[model samples]
Target: SCHPECNGICAQNMDSTSCTDPQTQYCSPYEYNSTSQSCNFEPTCVDNCDLCYNTIECQDCSPGYYLTPSKLCSETCPTGYYPNGEVCEKCHSDCSECTGPSDSDCTACVDPKRTPVSGICECSEGYFENSGV
Candidate 1:
């Protein structure tokens, strides 16, 4: 039976046997409860229960990444930073790829004394187009 109509009972006529609200009432796009014994509303589950940037809910990790229950969904580490303890981490500004903590995964084009923009080595001495250290 429809809600508030048959008082939640289906009559022998295959109808609510009483007044029941028809599905056309609200015109919902889709109802998870179509064949429901009674007229009750239900909710649908979405992926991952949580959402993250650059990541799809209930999905696998991208390359160079791993999945962990403690991790935020679809979370990504910035370039040069590796995944560590549910976050991305990088080595020293000088070393590449975990040579040591605080060391960079790749050497800087310019010294740390200079300002940085876009991870491209810029001139502290004031120059550009740096190939490597």
Candidate 2:
């Protein structure tokens, strides 16, 4: 049975029901606790996550953060990865920071000898491009 206002019909199951505000008449999302037969107003999404299906599964990230492949939100991407839109993408092998995956897309170089020149990494002075290094 539901509250008097609901006329014995809850929007969801008896164990789980949406909460409505008496003053504003607004409905808020809630989680059901079957054991207690009560609703919890706790947020379902994790911190830094804007959209999520649950506490640990994020679908989108807040500003300044990105959504990882594992559905976690991270402030910064790991090495060899760069923030692209709401996710992190792989960087070129020679680039520590880049906007894209191509070699010419490098914003920063992994090796000190290689310097960013017009978005591409170039060997300094006498230094030569070595694949082994």
lDDT of 1 by residue, 6-64 (tens): 33333332234443434434311112133654324432213332322122222244444
Evaluated against the true structure, the overall lDDT of model 1 is: 0.37
Tell me the deviation in Å of residue 14 in model 1: 50
Best by lDDT: 2
| Residues 44-87 of candidate 2: C-alpha lDDT, one tens digit per residue | 77778875534566767889898876778899887677788879
Superposed model 2: Cα runs more than 4 Å off: 1-41, 74-79, 130-133
Give TM-scores for every candidate, taking all chains together and pairing residue i with residue i. 0.23, 0.53
The count of backbone overlaps in candidate 1 is 12
Q: What lDDT is obtained when candidate 2 is compared to the true structure?
A: 0.66
